[model samples]
Every structure is written in structure tokens, then in C-alpha cells.
Target chain A: MATEVLQQDAQAPARAATLYHIENPEVENKAERFLNAFAAVLHFTDYKALLDSYCASSAKCGRCVASCQVYQVSRDPRDIPCYRSNLLLDVYRRHFTVGGWLKAHIGGGWSLTDALVDEMADIFYRCTACRRCTLECPLGIDHGLITRLGRYILSMAGIAPKALQVSVREQLEGETRNTSKLPEPALVDTLEFLAEEMAESLGVKLEFPLDQPDRDYGFFCAVSDYLMEPDTLMGNAAVLYAAGDWDRWTIGSRNFDAINYGLFYSDWHLERIIKRLVGEAKRLRAGTLLIGECGHASRSACQFVPVFAGQDELPVKSFIEYTLECIEDERIHLDPDIVTEKVTYHDPCNIARSGWIVEQPRRILRSFVKDFVEMTPHGRTNYCCGGGGGLVSMDETHEWRMKVAGRVKAEQIRATEAEIVVAPCANCKKQLKELVDYHELPCRVMGLHDLVLRAIDIPGGKSARQRQDEAALAATA
Target chain B: MEHWLELARGPLFAFTFLVMGLGLARHVLLQVHGLVTRKGQRLRQAPWRRIASSTLSWAVPVGHLDRSTLVMTTASFLFHIGAVVVPVFLAAHVALWSGFLGVSLPALGEGAADLLTALTIVCVLVLVAYRLMTPRARALTRASDYGVLGLVLVPFLSGFLAAHPTLNPLPWSWMMLLHILSAELLLLAIPFTKLAHVVLFPFDRLSEVHWQLRPGAGDRVAAALYGEEAHV
Candidate 1:
């Protein structure tokens, strides 16, 4: 029955995926032939020059390998940045160097066989492409970028995991970015439920306006929020309740999810996801488009979203940054009640190095939690949770991911012995949760807002009516 | 001796003129050709880029890149001492020039050039040693980086030799040519290698100015225009 269910869910999406058309029929044939022809001219190409220019101004030091969660978990030499990059580098050498292509196709260049491709694919997939490695490389090589592009090329060869394909297809369709596609009506109901909960809990009457055209702020949630992960939604509710700024933030009925699978595979899909976030904001007439606590979404929103949209500025802030702003403004008074225990913060890889969102969360954690011990290799140099880079959604590698991908993070958590682990990103939460259960660790994992909600002491805070409204919403679930 | 000096002066003057002229021409080509063809070129032309490229980046790296900044500052607090002392006191470089103009300024008495040369040698060695020792620097260390140390060491080694007479004008001229050639090769490699970061100084600062201007207009428009239904 479980296998049948899995097969049905997998096949359903693949069938739908065929309907929404994006064709480069030539991509397969051309790519194959190009690989064959370019095998000869690879030596003559400026690919190495391009790679070197992109890698860094100087030689890239592999100090970041020490911080990689995948490498830490796997303990495989192939997991190292130098090793992984060199694999791609081999392809680059083969296609660009005379001997490399000849050797790849024939026998002597550098062993470019199908097995090598699979190895490269595995190495690339294991990486969250979190950009943590970029920080430690004194030369500033963003190996994640290369790894992401490598995944894209591999997927073109129809070698991507079945689970990743489903999620990507769902995203490509109008379904949720996670494969747990909540229908539009279900999403509307969830918003209503959150609103009622917020009203009852905080006594601040709010409307989560569905499909509102252009408001002050378009609150974009991760697809997980509307689906199985109700805590992300509830935590968001708790934050909005804590803030009591109903007029300022509005959740869009349309364009709900911000999980761009294209972020995992294709530049085009990435662009579309970014656009949807902005368009939702514009549609709502939102002055600012605030995103929830998801690493890739925020990274996309903070960095690539604006870039892809050709916008001169971001219309919104990542929820963490936005929350920080609110706290700084004295909009939400944080009272340290629920979070009295010693706790450490885990910097999500996307936020740390790629997005450079290192300080804001630390400042927030410092303010909310009493004993905020920082994990080793903290800030822009933090390690990945292994469940990043579309791997979290890819169920095929679940066992390896739980065991190997999260090894570094689990070690970090264990070393802290902190009662609570605060990670603002959703994937971090998911990976940390899986690791906690799998490793049988005592620590709890949560979002920034969850901690804030639990700890906030509303001095003359919410009236009875608001408290009742929040209770009603919580009861409905 | 006079005839040989004449031969050295003519080439030095000619090479300096030719190289500097070419450098200027190449700069123009890079700026102009790049300007006309590259899309989104205007975005780079901001004041922030100018200030950042010119000032911030080099300021930090400069101290780390060479120990002479510290040693020279310590010796001549304001950088004025070495500036004034090295060129005016160096006998070979000054005499080589004066050979053409037919005027020789008196050296800064005895032991002065020797003292400055010794200081330069010490600083270069200390700086090279520092780079070799620091982990971050050591990790990035390359044969070429050391090659640069060796290249800089030549002038000091040869100048010291020429001063004492272990090497006469014949070998001195050869040493001087080697120094000039190495320096020239280093210059050409500047724009292409990590050394090109010296050039990035201006461009890096320029990018900072464009930071306020959103480069994501296309992204937002693209996002809005399509993918209303798509969630990923």
C-alpha cells in the first residue's frame, strides 16, 4: 500500500508535468553531441580561464571543507570542496582540453565515464549549495554556484531523483513548492484559521486578505506553511499577534509559495519564483513584501529575487530582518519568559554566507534568549544541515541525509547541550528535527518567531477578545 | 665607461616611454570598448564604486600584502623618509639617468644609500616571510607569489653588488635589464591574475555606488509578468 501510494503520488505529478511545456528537444541531442565534439576542442576553450576568474582572484583555499555538513556526515574524501570542484573541473578540462575529451571518450584523458558523471552528480547533490564554503575560501569561490549549475546540467540528462522531479514539477505547475499541494480553498481556509487564531490569542483583530490587490506589505509564506507544517504558519500567526501591526502586513491569497525548485535546478525556474514573490506583493499593492523563515526563499528574496525581477530595490525584507526591525522599533516588546534555558543559535548556510544575514539573527537571539551560546564556526562560516539544496524534499536520500547530511549540525547541537536550537530557516528546522529524532538528542529546534512567541511578555499585551480569537484558531486545527 | 652609460640611458628612457604609453593605450581600450558593448554598463558608473574601489579595498589589503608599509612607516612614520631617501640616494639608478641629461646630483653622503638599501632588503624579506607564515596567505601561496619576491630581491641584490664592485657595469646592466623585464611582466600579468584585484579596486568601489540602485528591476518584472500559477 505504501509503495502503491508513493507510486501514485510520483506518477500523478510526472503526468501533469508533461502538460506544462518547456521544450529544448535539442538540449539532449545537442548536449550529448557537444560533449562529444567539444571533447576535442576542450583544451582550446577558455573554460579554465572562466572557472579561474569565477573561483577567486587567487588560489581557493579549501578551509570551508572543514565546515561542510555533508562532508562531515559522509566522511568521504569525495565530499570535500576541492574534490567535488575538481570533478566538475575534470569535465571542464575534458571539454576544454585536448587530452581530457579524448581521454573521456576513448580511454586516457581523465576517466570521464558514466560512473564519473554519477559520482559528480552524487557529490553535487550532497551539497546544499548553501554558500557556507564561500566564506572560508580566502579567494571567495562560491562553490555552491558551480554545484547548483552542475545539478542543472545533470537533471537535463534525466538523472535527477524522482522526489526532486515531483517537487520541481509541483512548483512548475501552480501547486505548492513542496509536493504537499494544498488546494486554493484549503489555503484560504488556513489563512482564515490563522487570522481567527491571531485575533483570539492577541485580541488584535486582523484579516489575512486573500488575493488582495496591492497592500502595504505582502506576507509571502513558504509552501510548507499552508500544508503539513502548520507550526510555520502558527509561528507566523504568533509573530503577527506579537507585533499587532495588522494594517502593515497582508498575506496574499494568490502566489502563496516561495519555494523556487528552480533554485535547485534551473535559472529560469528561479527567476519565475522570484517574480511570483514580487508579483504577489505588487498584486496586493504591498509597499513591502516580507518573507517567512526559509533560507533559500530569503536568499532568493534578498539577493536573486530583486536581481531577477530587474527591480532597483527589494520591496520587502526576510521575516527575520523584518522582525528584527519591529523589535528595534519597539513595535513588539519581547519578554524573556519561555526561553530561560541556555541555548545556541545555528546560522542557516544560505543566510550566513550567501545572503550575509549573519548579525541580525544573532542580535535577535541575544535579545530574546538569556544564554545564547554561539555554535563553533558560527555566523557567515556556519555549516549546512545537509537537508538543503533540494535534498530535504528529495525522499530518495532520506536515510543517507538523516545519517550523513546532518552529521556536522548534529555534532554542533550535541556540543552545545543547549535546551533549544534557534534556526530562522524552515529547512534548517526540518533537518534539525529529523536529526534530533534520529540521533535521540535532547535539544529542541524552532524558528525565531516561535521562541519569540513563547517568551514574549505582553505588558498590558492582548485583551481577552484577542486571546479568545487565537484560542479559537488553535482549536480549529 | 661613458659610452656604456650612454647606451644604458637611451634604452631605459625609451622603454619607460614606450611601456607607459602602451599601458595608457590599453587602459583606454578596456574602458572604451567595454563601455560601448557591455549592457548594464552605466550601472557601474557610480560614485560609491569610485570611492570603494579607490579607497576601502586597498587600504586593508595593502597593510597585509606588504610588511614594508609597517616597516617604512616605523622608519619614516609618514612614508616620506623612504620616498625622499631611496631614489635620491640610490647611486646606480640616479647615475644611469644623469648619463642622459649630463647632470649628476651629489649622493646623500656616504653610507646613506647603503643604509636605505639594507632597510629595503630587510623589509622585503620580512614581508615575504610573513606571507609564507600566515595560514590564509600560506594556503593561497603560489610559486609566482614567491617569484615576485625573487624579482624584487634582484634590484637590492644587484645594487648592493654594484656598490661594492663584486659586479662591474657589465653585470650591473644585465641585472638592471632583468629587473626591468621582471617588473614589466608583473605589470602585464596585473590585470589578468588575482593581481588584477589592484584594478578591481576602482571597479569594486564603483559597484558599491550602484548598490542603492536596484539591479533587480528585470527580475521583479519577469516575476510579475509570468509564474503567477507556478509556486517554485
Candidate 2:
């Protein structure tokens, strides 16, 4: 008789039922539904090769154990990266491989079941998909990619976190065609308001151009920024004005939202979101897609755009890169003495984990900030703010994100003791802001653009104090 | 018992070696199939120098260490070194390979082989103890993990003892037979198990280079799930 090792833990505590909701009714049981999803995911994705290679080679060396923040906090057996990966890999081995088939026939192996599906639903969501563990694995087993694969398959079964599912559905199929369901008029009004605010505060008229054709750049920001990060949008407006002429960049009224929740869960949703950005870029007649301070959204376009478009139809450049270019080309001069508060940057995992977009932001920061501090392990291998992988959107998992997932990150930030944490990615900013508040750290989180806005030498723009000081100096002379 | 020992050393040894060799080849071929051009997917040209350098870095893995990983990574580096060195270069083992295949490989001297064998045993012990003691390692370990390590250590322990009978507690024939059987079991198991990382390591290290985002796939999957009107 086969011994069922995990069948006992099949009843393992899972918030999956609340988290996962499926509309499909054809499947007989949850196991069958999940297996069907696995087949579908396999059919749709080129992941069989990755799965086969990883299954054969992963040593489960526990080198990743120390790297995983979740494992460190929970100490749960399920949180181990390799062990969690095996939860899905075990199914593939048993069902897809010859040895596993033989073992199953001889009554000596485990199989995918309803309990295991529930367990995966619970555990897969807990991971932030930061890919820090991938950097640590000497064998190059991408545990973060495995988490994504698992999440992708689960999403197929309709067993995904409701927060992500809802947002994706809205972004792909809703009335406004964005995650937050913000209307085009509302976006227009917000940009107008931001421009008016910049004009009032800086004593110069700044343009927030929208739906303008034949522009050099089409800007896409995490839609949530319009609602919550107006300061960041204001900064982007000022910097773009200083960097390029008014006719150069425009925000598409239709596709200004850059946050792709699909990246966190479903590929179908991720691709759909990218397709909209491509369309938006074309609508603006853009030479490039300018992504704002959103981590996963930038990665979705930077990496996936080439994959989906089959050619680099529109070059994707992060706003950080664009700003650095402005600085390099002498188009914009950031006043280094302007920012006196000790400021440090948090590298969002999506942009930096692969060593892309890591250095440009630092160059931009060091150019302007008077007191710049670097986090202990800042670039590429930086810790997730616990709200990554779309946990930031879900109110239900907030406690878990704060207490367990965000713990290490909180410690990292506190150690920096910097007054300002400039998170270039919108997701990191949201998570880090909440993280500091939760941990009661003195640090405040802002988008990199938010800090740069204060220092940017906007054309003909100077504060009243600057004008007053100049007048006083002239009088004294 | 002597006849069994001879068979274990000759045809059975050849069979197990062939199995491992063929299985590893298949793994390499499958990985190549995955890594190379796929029909529906678009493959990006990965930066060749970076990949080469990155794969080399893992071999020595001197970078990417901190307080958290320094001790464990050091043990792993030592363990991998001994794991490869002792099995391939042991003087007694090279003779068998040379006679069977007519391909003579370099051999480690008696003192070197013994020292490496002892090192491998100690590293394996430290690793095993980690699994048994640490909750995370225990969680990560399956039964096969222990089985594989135990399989690897048996030959080193028994062969080391058989060579030095003064230190050997078991009878000579039993030690030789046990060593041969355990070695054969390990060889048969390697191709079919995680020990195949020995060959698959390079493939895993370079997996990122070829990862693609196939166009139309998302639509294909979505339509399949939610029908023709599935995707927006």
C-alpha cells in the first residue's frame, strides 16, 4: 500500500476558499480542476522545459531557506521555497514522468489532490515572488519563477487571490479598461489639477498634455498613482517639461494606467494589459513607452513587450532611465543641495532582480540628493516590501504582509535610518510607505520622481522663496 | 561471494555506468530542445558573455555571500568539490574505468584519495546533520534526499576501510561486496534522480537566457478557457 505522507496535512489551514474563486463548473473535483489547469498552463506556456530541468536538478539544498523572508518569519514547513516548488513539481513527476508513473502504478507514490490544490492556493499567494531566492540558488533554480508558474496554473483553475482576479478583470474587461476603474475624464481632470498645482507652487505654467498625436514618448503610470500618488505625477509632469519640449511626450487618455496586476497572477491578463500599452503607444505615435514609478508594470513591458510583440515595435524605457538621460544630456540640471533629508533608494525587484534599471536610478539620485545612503543590500538582491506579487491590493492579507512578509524589509529600512526612502516602483512605494508606518520607522516613502521634482530646474520655475532671496541679494548689493 | 564481487565489478558496473551515461545524455538533449528554438515561442538572444561569466561564477560561487549564506555556501562548495573529486579520481576506481573503456583517466594518490574521501564523508555528515537538526532543511528534505546522500557515502566509507584493513571493523569480503553494491545502486539512481544536477547544472544556470513570452499564447489559452469571446 502507498503511504500518503501529505494527505494528513491535506487538511492544512488555508484561506484559499476565501482567496480563490472559480467560475468553471465542468470539473469533477478540485484536484481534477487543478490538473486540467496544469495541462492548460503547460499547453499555453513554454515552461515544460524549465519544469523538467528544474525537477531533475533542484537539490533542495536549503540555501534558499535563509534567503526567504516568509520562511524566516513563519517557520512553517510549507514556506520553504524548494518544498513549496515541489508541491507542484511532485504532481508533474507523478503524472508526467515515467518513473513517477511506475511508482503510482505500484502503489508507492502520491498524487495531486483537492487538499494539495487548496494547500497550493494558500501557500503560493504567501510568496512575494521577489526572485531574491533565485539569486541565492547556486544551481540557478528559479524558485520565484516557479511561484509564478504555480500561480499561473492556479489562476487557470480560478483559484487565485480575489483581489488580483478582480483587478485584472477590470483592467482587461471593465468600462474604463484600467485596474482601478478610473475614467478617462477623471484622469484628464487629475492631470489638469496636477499641472495647475505645479504652476501655482512653482510660479511657472507646466503643460500636462493628453491624447496628443506624434509624440516622442507615451507615459504609462500605475493607475493607482493618479488616485494616491499625485505628488509623483506632479513630479513627472515637472521633470518631463524640463527634460523635453511640450510636443515631445503625451499621456494617452485611454491607456495611461501602467499597473498590470496580471503580472502577479494570470498571463492572459498580463498580455492583455501589454497589448493596450502597445496600442496606446501607437495612438500617441510614440517612439518609446515611458513607464512611471511602477515596478512590475515596467518589467511587464521591458521584458514581455519584446516577447509578445515578436519585435521591439516600441522601445520601452522607464521614466527613471529617461530622467537619467535628461541629466546626462544636460537637458535638466538637478540641484544637489536642494534635498538635505538623508535619502535612500529601494530597488524594486522587477526592475533590478535581473540587473536591469538598477544603476540609472542611483546615478539620478546621487546627482541631486545632498545626503544619500545605500541600503545594506540595495541593488538587484533587495528585499520585497512584503506587499509585492499584488498582496498590496488585498486588504485580507495586509496583516500577513505586515507581520510576516514585510518584517525583514522593515528591519532593512530601519537600519538605513534615512528620512526618505525613494521607491522608484509604485508597488514598492505603497508597500514601503505602509511598512514604515506599521513598523513606526521615521522614514517616509516617496517615488524617485517626487524627490527629483523638488530638485529639477524646471524652465522659468522658481519658488517664491527663491525669487525673494534673489531680490534681497540684489538690494544688498 | 567472490564471484558476486567479480560480477559487480565487471558487467554490472558497466550496466550501471551505461545507464547513468545514457540518462544524463537524454537530460542534456531535452534541455537543449528546451533551450534552443521552439516552434511557437520567440527566443531572445541572451547576452553571451554575461551568461558565460554567470555560469562560471556558480561553479566557484565566490560572490553573492553574506552573514546568512557564508557558512552554508562554504560547506556546499567543499561538499561539491569532494563529491566530484573522490568519485572520479580515486586510484582504485580509475583502474576499473581504464580497463573497461580503454580510456585511462588521471588518478589521485593514496594519501590524496584518502584525505578527499574523509573530507567528503565529513561534509556529507555536516549536511545530513543540518537536515536532521534545522527545521527548514528538514522541511525541504524528502526521503530520497537522505537516500541519495547515504548511497553516496557508503562506497567512500567501505572502500576507505577496505584499503586500510587496520582501521576496518568488517570482514574484507563483506566490505568489498557492500562497497560494490552500494556504488552500483548510486550509479543507477543518479540519472533518474536529483543527482543529475551534476549535468543539468549548466542548463539551469542558463535557463533565463532563453525564457520567452510567446505572442498569441495568452489569447490562445484564454479562448480555450473562456471561449472565442474570452479575451478583450
Candidate 3:
């Protein structure tokens, strides 16, 4: 029966109403009201005008369709980038444009129905907003922007995916400072546990400095890294410690998590999250803000922080760039023999395409790895990890994420024939891990710093076991 | 027929140019106004050089066109080149420009212009066939798309027939009048239709700041709609 249902869904891509059954009448009414309010907002006129411009000039060249992973995998007309963009474009035309007004008086024009709204919500969310399609589009029509706008409009209607909505709300209004809702005590415990693990394995005691004021750098990472990606956390601590910059760096009790769910859904949430990051940096009195291995978070802080938080404030930098700087300055020594496996790097869309942090990761990887192969189209032109634009966070979209969006990336990785895939972004790491599992690829997925931790040598920091063993030998002497 | 040709060459031509020029100016001015009025934090510096380079790169088939869609891309490229180059460089067009604008630009030879006109017509036909045949293209195709293609083809076809009056079915004067009328119609339709892209394409490409996730003006739009929440 489940297989039968899946087959039906595969056949009918436009049946979004059946897919997402919003049963509550009150909720539906509220959503509709919110959608109306969003539409009525005067500032949206600019978007309407932009949409109008697109409608006026769009050639429907279908160039973007060839580049779209979802469309390429699904082979569904509805999955085409232009077709997806037209969902919102149709809405803008129906109500906002002068042509729309004329058509309304003349009759036989499109009207925004509940089903159409539901369809827009359904299709828009399916896109990862990788903007790969935008690079190829002759008209420079950003289908990713259109998808985001459509999702934003639908979100206003309260028709957003529950996973994204709940997380954004929690980050903004919940007890915890981050989206993962990790409490202060738990965060400290997690860091300490990671340090102990590192000491046990690597013969070095790693310290996670917290809330130390007047630090040179304040480090922020995805809150999920504490629970799920302990190795990544350890790697970060290990690199910082090896660089002898541990004393100058600190993570604050508040705003330690750099993951911003807002960049995926709401501008309101994006602004709020960015404000928190800026406020946390100010409170810590850090000279520079360093974002951990999370692409969207790094992009949000690096690109939007200057705009939102003021240019004169603490400079935002990616942890990858910091690591590269440390390497260039010889602050940390790397033993290349530590990682002998064939490796390739996956460029996170936010990092490469959006932020232009392309070469830093490659330079770091080259410094350590014996053999580093590149995917067919690496760097700025690289495909999304199929988990970009918050798709990794949307658990409900997992099946679709793996099957449709992830197909291209899985193929890209498989083509490289690498033993290990180093994805710098936490979101890409998670998505790549899933791709590895789903595709049954032999490669292991890891963070850039994971490789760094394996290869890095700390001068004075010794393991507890080594220290104990040395003391016993001295006693025997 | 002679009277109609005289009117098309004189008053009608001037009127079409006026509308095309004014419409293009208004469209460009509105976009500029949008950029100026947009609120929120702006980029520390505009990436003018990168934008110009990116625009040039995107204008050709070398970098921007995907390999899978080469046929359509190549066809589109040929059509655009012919559409722009042939019109600007044709001896007749040069003569008109010399008379109207006091600019006696170099002109393409008759044979070269004829060959380009033929290639452009063939390209347009191939594009129209692809639009009708391909499922994805068919899905995106509208009456306006076909109308634009046909509208463009008319001037090219009429111009070719006028150039070769011996082989033409219609009278030389009538063919000339049809060519002028069709070209005028295309010019008039520029701002009102997809032809607006001809003028807006450069601004659209150059205006986008590549480093930022959203366009530079995007934050202001967010602020205007979402209020204080968007402003931080």
C-alpha cells in the first residue's frame, strides 16, 4: 500500500494538497490571513516590481532546467527551475501587475486559489536554492531567489514546513540561544567530553574556552555539532590549540551556535539571528568573530553581518580561512602521512557560490593530504550537496532530498573515486554522510578540520596516558 | 503603395524610434530609481568591474551555455548576433543612420548581410520548431513567445525579399514598406514584451553583487516589507 502511494505521488507531482494535509480549519484561516497581510505589506511592492520585470522579459529558455538537480533527477515538468519560479511569478502577475489588472477586468485570467497556494508551498520547498541554475541563466533570473521568495510568501501564510518553522521559533524565543536548543550546562559538558576524547585518542588535552571576554576571536558552530559531530568539535579545538591561539579564542555561553535557520525561511528570523551573533560578539568583546564548519552560517555572518550589524564592528571570518592562515604562518605543523587515503572536497553552495570561500579549503587540504582529487566541477561551479538551503534540516523532505536533490552530488562524488570526502560545512557533512549511506559509496564523509585533527601536531600538549607512562618510567629510573 | 512606403520611411519611422527610445529610457530610469530608493545596509563597495566581466562572459555561448542544451543555445546565439549585427551594419540601415543621426558607420557588404539574414531566419525556424517539439520548451511556450519569434522573422524575411526584388513575389516598394513596418512593430514592442531584456539584460547582470547571497537591494526590500524585524 505504501509502495502504491509512492507510485501515485511519483505520477502526480502537482498534488501537493494530498501530500500535506493541513486539517485544522482555524490554522488554515490564520495562514490565509498571514498570507494576505504579507501581500499587503508595502515593501513587497519592490518584489512585485521585480517579479513584473521577470514576467515581462522571461524567454522561458529552459536553460535552467538542464542545470537543476531536482528537474534532472525527477524528469518532471513541474520540477523545472523556471516552472517552479513561475509559481510565484503567476501569483505576482495575477494580482500585482498592470497586465494582471487588465486581464482581471477582461476575465479568464489566473486567480490564486487555495490549491495553487498549497502547490506553491509544496514545489518551492523541494528546491535546495543552490543557485547553480542562476549561473547558467542568460537573463540572470535567479530561480533560487524566486524559490526563497515563494517559500517566504508561503511561510507568511503559516504553510511552511514544520521542521524549519519550529527551529526558527525556538532559536528566537526558546530557552536556548541556538536552534538545537542545547542548554548551557549541556554545551559545557559536551565540550569537556570532546576534550577528554581527544586526549584519550590523540595524546593531547584540548580546551574549549567559554565566555572569556576580550578574546581575539569568538568561535561559533552549529549546536548540533555538540551532540552529533563530536569529532568536528574536537578537530576545531585541536587545530586552535595546535596553533597556540587557544588563549585568545573563546566560545560564549550565549550564541555559541552559528547555525541560522532564518536564512532558509524568513528574513525576520535571519535579521534576529544575525543580531544575536553580533550581540554575542559585542558581549564577549572579541576582536573577530569566527564561524565554524557551517556554510549558511558562515555566509550569513560574513555577508549579512556587515550589512546588519554595521561595518565597524568585529570582522567576521570563516574557521576554514583561519585554519589556512595558521598553516601559512606555520603556527601549526601537519604530518601528511597521517591521512594517506585519496580525498576530495565538496564545496558547500553557501561557501563557494555565495561567499567565494573556495580556495581556502583546497589550500588547507593540499598542505596535508598526499592525494587530493577534485570532483568534475569543483569550486564555484560545484553542485550542491543536495542538502543545501535548509533541506538537511527539513526531516520531512529526507526521502525527496536523497532521491531528487542529492542524486547529482552523489554521482559527482562517485565519479571522483575518492576514499574520503571532506565537506567543510556541517550541513553538507550531514547530507554527504546520508548520500554515502544511501548510495552505498565506499567513501567516508568528514569535516575539513577532521582531516586537520588527524594530521596536526601540537608541540607541548601530551596525552594523559603519555604523561603518566613517562612519569612511571622516570620513577623506575 | 508608394504613399504608404513614404509614410513608413518618414513619420511612422520617427514615431517608432521615439516610442522605442522613450520606453527604453523609462524602463532603465525606473530600475535606477528602484536601486536608489531601496533601504537598509548597502555594500561597502560596488563590484563594477566584476559585474562588467560577468556580463561579457554571460553574453556569449562559451561559458554560460550548458553543454546539454548546445543546439538551442547555439541557435539562440546565432539569431541574437544576426538580429543585432545585420540590422546595425546593413548598407541600407547605415544610410538611414547617416541621414538621421549624422553617423556614417561602416556597412556590411550585400552578400555578407544576405548570408547573415538567411542564417538568422534558419535559426529562428529551428528555435520555433524546438519550442513546439520539446516537452519542456512546449510547457514554457506561450502565444507571446511564438508571436515574438514570428514578429522578428517578418522583418528579416521582408528585408531579404526587398534586397532580392527579382525573386520577390510582392512588388519592391511593398516589400520595403513591409520590412520597415515589421521592424517598427518590433521596436514599439520592445519595452512592452520580452524584448525589454535587450535593454535590461546588462543592468540585471551588472547590478547583481556576486559576493552577497542576495542582491544588494534585497535587504531593503526585506526591511520595507517585514518592518523593524528585518532591519536588526
- List DockQ for all candidates: 0.09, 0.58, 0.37
DockQ, candidate no. 2: 0.58
Error of 3 at A264 (Å): 1.3
Number of the top candidate by lDDT? 2
Which 10 consecutive residues of model 1 chain A have the lowest summed lDDT? A16-25
Please give, for residues B117-211, the per-residue lDDT of candidate 1 as tens digits. 67767766765665566443344445656766565566565656556656555565565555455444544454434454333323322322222
Q: Which window of 10 residues has the lowest lDDT sum in candidate 2 chain A?
A: A16-25
Name the candidate, 2 or 3, with the larger TM-score value: 2
Q: At residue B96, what lDDT does model 3 achieve?
A: 93
Query: Candidate 3 residues A320-380, lDDT tens each?
Result: 9999999999988787766789999999998798437999999999998999999988888
lDDT of 2 by residue, A159-196 (tens): 76666776777777888988888998898788788878
Which one wins by TM-score: 1 or 3? 3
Pick by DockQ: which candidate is best? 2
The lDDT for every candidate, in the order shown, is 0.58, 0.80, 0.77
Docking class of 1: incorrect
